[model samples]
Target: MDDDSATGVAMTRNGSTGERQLEGDYLTNAQGEDVVAGIRMTKDLSELKKEMPDLYAEFERIALLLEKHYREMQDMEFTIEKGKLWMLQTRDGKRTAQAAVRIAVEMADEGLIDRQTAVRRVKPEHVDFFLHPQFDPAALAGGKLLARGLNVSPGGAVGQVAFDANMAEAWAKNEGKAVIMVRPETKPDDVHGMLAAEGILTSRGGRTSHAALVARQFGKPAVVGASAITIDLTNREMTIGERTIHEGEWISIDGTAGVVYEGQLATMVPDIKDPWLIKLLDWADSFRTLGVWANADYPRDARRAVEYGAQGIGLCRSEHMFFETDRLPYFQKMIMADYPVERREALAALLPFQREDFAGLFRVMDGRPVIIRLIDPPLHEFLPDLVELVAELADLKIQLKHAPDMAAIDALLSDIRQKEQLRKRALSLREANPMLGLRGVRLGIYIPELTSMQVRAIFEAACMVVKEGIDVHPEVMIPLTSHVNELIRQRTVLEGEARTVMAEQGVTIGYKFGTMIELPRAALTADRIAEHAEFFSFGTNDLTQTTFGISRDDAEAGFLIEYMEGGILPANPFATLDRDGVGQLIDMAVRKGRASKPDLECGICGEHGGDPQSIALCHQLGLTYVSCSPFRVPIARLAAAHAALQETGRPHDE
Candidate 1:
């Protein structure tokens, strides 16, 4: 039989000379001794029962026997040669996430495996991938391949090309078009566009780049560092070899595969509420000892996390709350203000927005703890790029020389001068290393009103929610505390402002004050720092950066990949907890802090929290919870359960 031939049945009969021969006259001229007549072929396995009843019965019996012997599903291969069936091979088959879930559930139901074995078979990444949208296989097969890059985030997206952040935002919000934001790289300033676009594509940067980090946080599809593609921002186009794609042209990207396609492709969104997935997660919850929380900054995220069975909110970066179009201007004004009163006015303007946001989150996560981190990033992040401002100022000066009249000349000069002043101020604030400079607790301490304002908002929101008969557990976290005095100073401000808010609202609500142990100093001296802290939330993203003496944003796009490939590093420290270096700090901090304050609640709120290996490490360290993005809550829950099962060597009775 030909190896490529379809599965079929061939008929034969015994001849007078004791040889197998064709039973019909149609095979009279056939050369083979076992020439067959009325051969039937089928691509379906079920069709075999009708075409070859005996063979199908034998195949089913063999399959069942193999499965029983192996104690798992068996993928068998068989061949038919000269009308005789021959078994070829049998092994465990690889499966997609959907198949994995269904098989696990069905096998447990069939008594082939217990529920614990079923849960153990399904990996956490399988659950995460099963919940997202995927490209239709047929459509993707026909798509024209443009380039491939790092699969920084998972999902399928198809949209028109957008070159600039402003244009991407406008095309998405105003024209109501799905957009893929294509850039050489993204920065903190492009967050609005990243939010507005359907997906993100960058020609430069790796997994931990700004583009990748933000894309994962927002649960958007992203392909980064496609070096084969060249982005020409000046012409608003991108080129891959001979192919040039202009703005508004259709394109499709599979972030899971890191492939860029020339045109749109069909997509299928999986049902996250699939019955089997729900049952598995419920079993996971029963087994997990460590709590799984979400790092949700908005009410919508909090609601989604709750639906995914998150216990609480672990880290809410208050700085992210200021990135909205309506809020960014006020935040920028607060950053650029020259005097105390002006800054206070800007902060006051922002207070109502913060309060309303917190109130919404509190209402959604009514009985869950919400840890709101004070404004963490450096002030320079909120300001316009100094280089862009200087370039604009120079362009205005050139236009000034070609003015049509005195009125135009005066207007151009005034604009030029104002831009020049703004450029000077931006340049003045620039630091050689802004990440290590004025950020987190340093910023809060340098300008006491910043933390003071945020604490007031948190307390005010909690008080308002409490009066509405909602139980709220608000945690005020002071970010980047390297010394006991820093925590002490911030705690004093927090308590004072919290007290003021409760008195004003005429309501009392329970709350906790904590500090993020993100620096080596903080971890080493955690005993002293814990004196003022009721809890400790490890900011491993920064801790890894600080401990490694490398900037995560820069290293990931640069030597980090080389390090991992060369075996200099076991894994990306930013993605997985460095068990020897960074992990030691976390262990030390937890032990030291708990020693000082016996009830010190410790948890991790970092990118690693969503990672399976990192979640296991957090469990091993005896942390209270692991907090990750809202979309990753289910993955974290499952991983936490796996950790518990492995440690305890048994499953919880359902």
Candidate 2:
């Protein structure tokens, strides 16, 4: 053992099977806890070597012997007092993803391990870490690190502070500043803020918590369960020991490292220039049996997915496209239109936009299959918030009452009345339970033109792509489908639109139509529905919601955490698959759906798709594919490979 270095000098590999390094630290005139607890500034093992060369040489010799004896790396701890060296402890060293890959590959090449053994050494989570950006080494070395926490998501983030979700969103959206949302813990209501923020820092909650789960899903940099920091929401500041960080203070965070820095720090994007990871993924693909796809909506997402090795587009939620700034007007106009002609005209205005959107996606995906789900949410989602509209109308009425000019007063009154009408319409559209209300296939059935316009755009885009000699497999997916008739009705409408577009473009292209088996009834009666549907995509998000009768949006914020802490639920069913209840439904659907139509293709396009555990379950259940967000494509690929290896009785390190 050597003094002034790592507490325990170990020659052992990390959880990731990373390469071992002579890693240790030393603080002058301090106890071992000072160095171990990181309470004092510390120097690396090299500093000790510089101070005592003879002792350092002897320590290195013993370390090598320890590794040889164990046939692996070792972690060691020792002390040197009065020019005498002492070996206190020795074990394997922990390392980063890069070190893990480099070490394993080098070990295999060095005859320390076989190729299969090396492959088995790397964890799936480590593979995921390779895909995220890191803080620049030089910048991080110079930066002031405030605290450490569990890294729920992997990436580097730099932004000003925001105390709560509302502040986070307001700062990001209104001030146009990237913000790190600081919270005691997060709730479902914080999603908007989470989306707007560049990173999230919470004082409580572990990896499987709501905050962490959503952060991963959003692909944000997140550090959770940070106990060192105390959040003072009343003052909009966070206190770490004696240091207080106020709102809007510039800060940087490394989710991969789980370090919160005092100010902005430079970041290095993943080393895509290095072909090592690319080669590794290719190797993974060779061994993996499950198909990994992406839940992408736009061309950008599709392109990202393709770059990350997504096999195809498993879910293209077209409704998300409507939320884009330029396209929202057409969507809102269609929603507010009183007559079918007006709505159709609004949809007509949107047709070219949708066609172009689909065309771009096809171009990016090339010949890969793209499953596009038609509009699924209720129309109210396209309108202004009912409460906000009413408040605006009330303020307008007050202004009208105070107006000095008669003409101005009359105009104000007219405007107020118009606002009131829109507000009333929005209210009328609102349901006590919107998720279980008029959404998905029901929306398509009730509002024929909505589905018609989307189908028309899809078919027309396909025809255009086919005329250009690019093979495009466009699948129209009807969401929230619970019955055979819903599938048949939407299929008929989609087929009619397909015919119309084909005839109009003077081109023919084959397409598939499917329904999302979200409702329990749909899964239970999958055989009957499969007869009318060409494919099935399990919408596990809503499936979990309906199965447990839990409102995903509101549950976590309310009693979900309590239930979790109380051990009422093993995990957040929304975050992870509830295999017994929700999984049973999934199993039954896959079995029955395939029994009815042996050629039926099935996959899951939900939040669960990106979860490694859920991916394993899907693999075990024989699902064709699992689709997740574009950023999760790499994670899913690695997870799928891990699952395949585990099933085949190969080394499953993860």
Candidate 3:
């Protein structure tokens, strides 16, 4: 394969030839002041070299287990060098553009790595995630997790937990407290609370919901669809079935895992400097310089600004394009319209609005790999109920006068009535439990036009940008894919349409189609998904929620908090990772995906990207990259450096 400038020639499948070559390069780079910048390198230590069931040793077991758990590229520091592999250190690694600076420059200071090696480590894309507002572990501990929900945004908060938007604003009104607004879901009215609250929460909504969009717009922590707790807006209180709680109660919410607790719980912010992180990235930098990309749905996610540096965006969701009001209306228009033309027209109305949104994003990224996930939600989400529509028709005929206006209303009403009937039938056909139901690819299967409009808009944006000479690598990803057949089907529709539009406009472009490995089925059947997918981005958020059978929306209000507080659940699986459970799938998926397709690009786009421990794990796993919001990039980069440097402290390998 050709190099993308940042990547270098790597070792082959066999370790002996590549290992010897890498050793020579390692010596030269180590000696010169500018070795990294100039020397082309490669190191391939395959599974065959690392695997030997009979060569049993403590470190070997540890290394094997670490590899088994992570299922990706691994850099482990072991006590033994030749005879055995001792577990001295382990971390998934990738360098931030800044950390590349620090490692190459600082290593020179320490007489370890020289200046040229530093520039080689730094890449154009890697530096971007570092430039956002990141939390110092001290800052994370500075505040508290009053109540936990999906931490859509990374970092910490010190604020009064207000139940409603109004309370959030009122509390934030007086002074020092950075208000953390709690809500069952956010509305346009909640915009103020979103403005006032340090973070936001919702009873229902996906990564592409109103609450997520508004919070991301404001750069606030958002935990959406946390339906575990019922909010009593009338009583100014909330209920999690048996437990009743009122407003003004101070609690910490872990937006990462949707875990809400009674009071401030102790926090352990994983350090970007953990020795494990440094050792890992150093190993990655030693190989191909392929710019690592992150999948981001929001601008504030700071994909470019995470602690563990990500090169740029691999996927960015565009339909996460509106606030509460716009979402329902846009959805309603798509669902309630009498004809495909009507719905397509409604989507057309949203086009200019979407283009403008992408324009701002283009500005944020400047020029990088921003793979926009086209609209992938079900149409029913936007439509009002048939029962409600029927009721409206009855009210109009029974209450209004008999005139031309009424006649026109009657005609339109008849069409609406037919559409309502079909919609009702569709609902009945839907699965009893819709989370694993008629969503994702199914929506595209029936409503192929929905995917069509989104693909066109994305391409139009690309064309708009391309005409300006801006290089944009747009990636289209299919969500909720439990089956490989589903991804292939969805891609056929999306790619087919995108190609058509490209041809008509006389614009040439290239994009990758991939699936988000967020389900057990997706992971278990990864080899199949890889056959159709150009790359893979592990959607650990949904993956975790589905894996635990926890309502990401409601888990916090019920018993997850209790479980964490009582030490039943070590940490919210949403916040940290449940390595044994969900991680096992990620490990399986990577190994299977690679086994089927060597050189398959893989990465993580969940909240774990900024997490120091998770980042280290990604380093050890041999993942292509770990992506978080832009703000968290700097921290990710530093964490990557730590994983690399940790190798130094390992009881010298020899």
Candidate 4:
């Protein structure tokens, strides 16, 4: 009715209040109702409403007819002015990727889209999303959505929604289902469910959440800040600000865009690759013949990335190897074990586990190059809290006059206290500003054994897999090194043990040693580090962290929201490469590093690996490859194509 600003196409409804339709730049409700919105066009709405009411009615008639004809959601724009109605735009409504493909393919089969259109509809990236691990779609039909947040990662999960992550993990194990991890905000503790969940859903957090980042790292589906849905733990039901559903039920979460849908909606791949992804990479490949790659975290993800045509794996975070349900207790013991002898014993027990993981990885990659980053997070991450241990031990001592497992409890408490002291010392060692802290090289320097054990595992896995007739190529990447000597030291130790092991096995297999150019210093001195290294996998996650001095985990909820909305940042730097700043660093490193060692291999292992923009940037920089999550491999390839074409054509940036 009030159509002063909106580009309303006037139509008569019983001639009571002359309603209008929305055309170019005008916002119309799903039912074509006027909501205060419009874009300026040359059409004269005042004259049209006065002169051509019948034509306007005809246009609305067509929209209704088309909706009936298609039997699905539709979006359209119409112009009605000066006694004439005009059709300006028409397309299927914006839909979930699942619905997008299904509708496209089904409609195409039903003669909606042509053969050429069908081919265009099926995006390689969309297919990758569809093929990845998903929760039991059947289970989610009973639950309801509580909130809507950014779906930074993709996958599925179902469990009794636990307010806390530990309880979520416990309930997941007890109920024998993947966890639906709910939290106001996540911390390092959620890394456990980020490990345990089939998919992750959080009440708080956003695209850069520890939950989101960890999920992306592990290739898990994650929905953050479903603030719309209210979780009531006492009654065990969630209300979507409307209807309420009880616990133990399910809700389907789409991690692509943070939308939660009702029921186990059927899923399909993307019908159309975003023209952006395709066009961007096509531009890159023309400039550089880099072999785009991906960092796969799981078997299915491995295949998905390969299907996207990634040349090889640049980084496979081997720490995720110890996150499996069967492995965490052992991992905890390995971390908390008081003596080196005990730690080594625990690590020895993990060798077979690590070997099996590598075997699976090799099987998935089918012996392709997989550069694995050794264990990264601090030891305290794997251990229980010292405060909790103290409280529990005291509680047990008080509740039971004698005590139950008092010795073990006291021992655990004592060990926790000691570890706390070590943690404090580590924190002191930690940079007051930790992105530059004693994280990467410092951790390796202080805990050389941790790196050694993992190197032994990699070599041992390589040897075993080679015996099984798989041509496995393993590479080792050291994280957070500012100076060349740090890499030289790590490489010396790795090569020495690797040589000794190879001599013992009598199988001459090759492995590459590399350092993550994640610090400004490392990138600046890449030429120096390249001297002893065979490859460089840019860990942009840390590089960006170091560059901006922003803790990705800390900024998502509080400042990033305002920063993005305020236009302080163009896009999420972690999600997309900050081409101007971080990218320049990569370019500098590549040029300088290759200058030192012409044959040195260079690629990326940051979240940017799969980002189309990052892919194009990497290609332009002449790196040998770019690596990303398996799901993003297809997007990267098409993006590579886009980049290639654009590079050669020098097309204007979109």
Candidate 5:
């Protein structure tokens, strides 16, 4: 064969046309000249088709035949050897989420596959990626790359960098600027900043870190564990190599790609108005046996969940309701109160706000089961940082020492006294390990009033919404119940407050009381706990932490990433379910709980609920549902269908 005559051909079927199309064809040497630097210039596909029409036709025929055999789009590579067309390789073509959707729909339309098979072909992540904004290919190519990190959440974000949570909140809220929260690692206290920011970036932490979890919950773009980036909190800047990104500097991040770039990059939001996605999800709903629910706290989230086809609100975290600017002060007052009367007064002030919050969610959910987990975090989380309070007090003392007048001295002394008291209180409440300390059921039991207050608020809200002609199914879940007695105690408080509210409103409302199976002991003794509880929502976030004896936030930001990368661990157990350890616990709990009450309703309301692998396990274990963030409802819906289809080996209709 002549060197110039040898040609390579690549072909694929156009999704819209189903016609064999030559993607590219190139000759080894167009001029038949000696190669310079062992490189060969090539002729284009048009030239190849013009010169060798029969050869091109033969390749096209072969491509179509391969595609037909595979029953999918075939990417074929071929070459001419000794004037004869030779096939090199052929396989299913890889495609983008956009292409995947278009191909699936077109293939179904072409009668190559049924609608159910089309739904099964596309993965949940593909659907999720289809919904998020992505960096424009042209703009992304032109942009200067800064660093790369774990793609904790899927989306694109453009904003000015903010070093801390307060700066992020101030910049976003006060100046109306879109801020990217740049933190070493985020704590629960930094949630306000995370909520305000357009996206979150952290120098440390893996995909299941606090930053990752909250970003997913809020549906914000996030890149965590960017080890290349060094955050200097004191200087309000992050350094990547020799490049320093100061606070208020423009930066864009591709959370899906996990790439950080300097300055703004244009992004294109996917046309979520695609009819194919709607059709695919409809098919998913038909096949799925496991219920898909949303971990929604606010009415807005609930509404979005409904729009995305969430069957119900699986986890309504009541603590998130108190984090708003208008409500935090009252909650803090309640936390800092020295006496029960003072605490009750503060709780009384917060009751109306709580009621309104729950009522709004209930009204949006429209009678779907809303499993509301009562206040779970430790009290110290609500208070001002002890370090910040101490610093302020030290500054105030310095001012008091140099007071120029009696009036000034008196005012300084008053401020000093208040700061001192707060510092003391914060110190007293601070725990060596807050996660294992006074949180969840312990906090509620320590101050039964807190549980009573939240339960009353829930009942009052349900009653209010019920009277407004809205159906309400409130499932009050007690968090972190290691002992059956704790559930027994909290259930009594829940029922009493519920009865009192129903009597006051002159209307009875139906509600279920339940406990979150977060601790090993709780899982071990699930039968006893189930005896008192009407439902069990597995809080796998803490359950994983407790089972592994690792703090999720600390571990993910530290050794957990190493564990995953070093091959000591298969995956981040926080992100995917630890099927052996945590899964065993869950399976045992479900079996034991069902043994006690055969009709016991069980589900998971953790970060894992949104994970496809975990959702599959939950399906295998016969859990009732999986509750993820509002944004993840569609993903869960599709994943649940996949789980069901995998089990049954056919669509629901078949």
Candidate 6:
């Protein structure tokens, strides 16, 4: 054995997928980072046993001793000096969510730690990582790998390449194309493109780089510091391994493996429904007092959340139901209707859609409390893009001028008129800032009938489910409430409608009414709002926006990245809770709201709800539940458990 000797490390088992032995290549004359950096070619680690049998045996003995001493899995880095093995370092190993849970439980079974301690050992973020899809091993093996980099985030993505942020954004948004943004390194200016792109590739940056941190927060696949690839920003191209790919060229990136492929490779969705994971969550449940719900809008998502062990539905956004192609026309008609009768007609048509959507959600939830939020976004989202419509209208007018057939000209002229009218209406609907404009309760208050339709749909759906003898706990949640009267006005309409529906159906179904405490005003005045509201579900996405006066969509796309990377902002307030500003508001609201109504339920159903740090904060703030995306339920559950364990100090062994 020598100082420059090739070193090999093997995990006796696949720490990720529970496969057989997982071993890596042996790198000579290089440090550990060199091997992980994928900077040079290497040989198999198993070859070391044959090359140095006596040394390998001693190394094996030391590895076992270290693992036993640590009482946990160890990542051992060692060097051999002239036939003698010297253990350089040993620490708790980095394992995937599956591996972490499996190892922890097995260690507990072996009496190394208690089951509660086992639950505390695994991080919440790892659960989120486990839920992401992985590249198909067979497909990856067959594909031409262009380069390897630091896997900043974990997931797989395939898309046409874009050299810069603008190109990525334009390609994705304007052209309706998926893009993989490639850069020498990303800056705050590239945030917009980063958001639009399916994945990101950088020639330089480490795991904790701005690109990496942002990508992980957004759950986008990203590879950073692939120095093997040379990017030409001006040419909108990148060269890797003697091959050059231009803009729009197809490429696949596996952030988990840190490999970039020449073309789209197949992928397999990893099912986090492993029995070991379920057992891990069950153990988490025993330790945590906080509830874990999901922000599911569809029946499929609701079912998936239940499978993932969600306690209830926190924010079932009703606007998502309108985005379906079949339902968009009716919704657009409602948005563009000139008169109340016309609007009512459109709302009537949309009634069946809402009813069916809610019924399906309730049926899948099977009496799990479902918080149905009324439409929240501005109407323009439901309408055709005004700019695109205007462009189309211009093209049609030119076609009309050149038409040969009289009938064709008439039809073209009619289409032009229709599009022009819609475009005008859409333009009129546009606001300087839609996020602060006619949306949520403002929209509902302006058009009470619109809110009434959603309320009617909810109660009607609940009754339909009730007829099947299934208990239905439907909570009507009004979004974007800024004042107590706002909640009061909506509650009056909602309750009156609910009572009417119950009377009509000849069945009385109990339902609670609530408001989303999204604006700073709402939280500050929660005591007053709670008087009329049955519960408060904090919509932190909007709450963060309103509190900081930064739009969620714009903040990430603009200066927030710089603010974060430059250490100006401590963290992305959108991803992690702003404990000072937003947290204070939440604390005020929770304290006053609960005081106003003793049993007033409180929860958070925002992106931060799933975030491990945010979940811990929510638990500390006395939130009853934390809800996130369907895939994030396990993460939230684990985070809640971690928070509870920390408070109680019951599992301190880890």
Which is the leading candidate under TM-score? Answer: 6
What TM-score would every model get versus the actual structure?
0.78, 0.83, 0.55, 0.62, 0.79, 0.85
**Residue 431 in model 3: lDDT:** 54
- At residue 88, candidate 1 shows an lDDT of 65
- Write the residue-wise lDDT of candidate 2 on 1-654 in tens digits: 233333323344443335455656655445567667866677777776787788778888887778667655666777666566678876556777777667766665566665555666677677777667778878988999799999889889899999888888998999999899989998878888999999999989898787886787667999999899999989888999999999989989888878899988998876643455565666677777889999998898898899888989999989988998998988888888889899999999999999999998988888899999999988889888998998898899789778999999989988887787789779889999888899999999988998898998898888888888788999889999888888888888779888988999998887888999999999999999999888999999999999999888777666886687568898889878998999999999999999999999999999999888999999999999999988778778778877888889754332
Give the 10-residue window scoring lowest on summed lDDT in candidate 1: 13-22
- Model 2 scores a TM of 0.83
Which is the better candidate, 2 or 5, if ranked by TM-score? 2
Off by over 4 Å in 5: 1-66, 77-89, 138-264, 650-654
**Which segments of candidate 4 are over 4 A away from where they belong?**
1-288, 297-309, 324-343, 400-438, 650-654
lDDT of 4 by residue, 1-654 (tens): 233222343221111111223232232121234422332234443443344556545755776667556644456666433334456665556544454445444444455444334334445455455546454445445545555788788655444455666766777677677456666567765566556666677677666556766676566777888887777767766677677766555556777657676545444443224443343334333334667777876767777776656667888777777878788877777656668898888878888888777667777676578888876665555555556655665664455455457787676666656655545543434335545544666677877877787787778778877888888888888888899988888778877878877778778787788888888999998989999888998999989988998888776534654576467887778888999999999999999999999998988888888777777788788888888776666666656655665566543222
Name every residue pair that clashes in candidate 6.
none
Candidate 4 C-alpha RMSD relative to the actual structure = 10.6
lDDT of 6 by residue, 415-445 (tens): 9888988988888888998888999999999
| Model 2 CA RMSD to the hidden true structure, in angstroms | 4.9
CA lDDT of each prediction against the hidden true structure: 0.83, 0.83, 0.60, 0.66, 0.85, 0.85
Residue-wise C-alpha lDDT for candidate 5, range 1-654, written one tens digit per residue? 575356554547553333445565466533223222236665566676677788778877887778777778876666676568878778887666766776776777777788778888988878888678888878998999999999989899999998888988998899999988888888777888988998988889887677886787567899999999988888888899999989899999988878899999999987655777887788788888999999988999899899988989889989988899999989888888999899999999999999899899999988699999999998888888999998999899889889999999999999888888878888999999888889888888899998898889888988888889999998999999999998888788779889998999998988889889999999999999999988999999999999999988777546665576567888888889999999999999999999999999999999999899999999999999999988788889899999988998854333
Q: What is the C-alpha RMSD of each candidate to the true structure, in Å?
A: 8.8, 4.9, 18.4, 10.6, 6.4, 4.6
Which model scores highest in lDDT?
Answer: 6
Q: Please rank every candidate by TM-score, starting with the best.
A: 6, 2, 5, 1, 4, 3
- Scored by lDDT, model 2 comes in at 0.83
List, residue by residue over 1-654, the lDDT tens digit for candidate 1: 343222322222111111122111212112223223334222345555555567667767776777667756565666555545666677675566766777677667767787887788889867987678888878887999999999998889999999988999999999999999999998767878888999999999987677887787567899999999999999989999999999999999888889999999999987778788888888788788899999999999999999988999999989999999999989877877899999999999999999999999999999999999999988888878988997898889889889999999999988987777667777877999988889888898899998898888898899888989999999989998898998887788779889888999899888999989899999999999998999999999999999999998777655665676467886778888999999999999999989999999999999999999999999999999999988889899899989988998864344
Candidate 1 vs candidate 3: which has greater lDDT?
1
Off by over 4 Å in 1: 1-42, 79-89, 137-264, 395-421, 651-653
> Model 3 off-target regions past 4 Å?
1-310, 322-330, 363-367, 378-380, 383-432, 647-654
Query: Against the correct fold, how does model 5 do in TM-score?
Result: 0.79
TM-score: model 6 vs. ground truth = 0.85
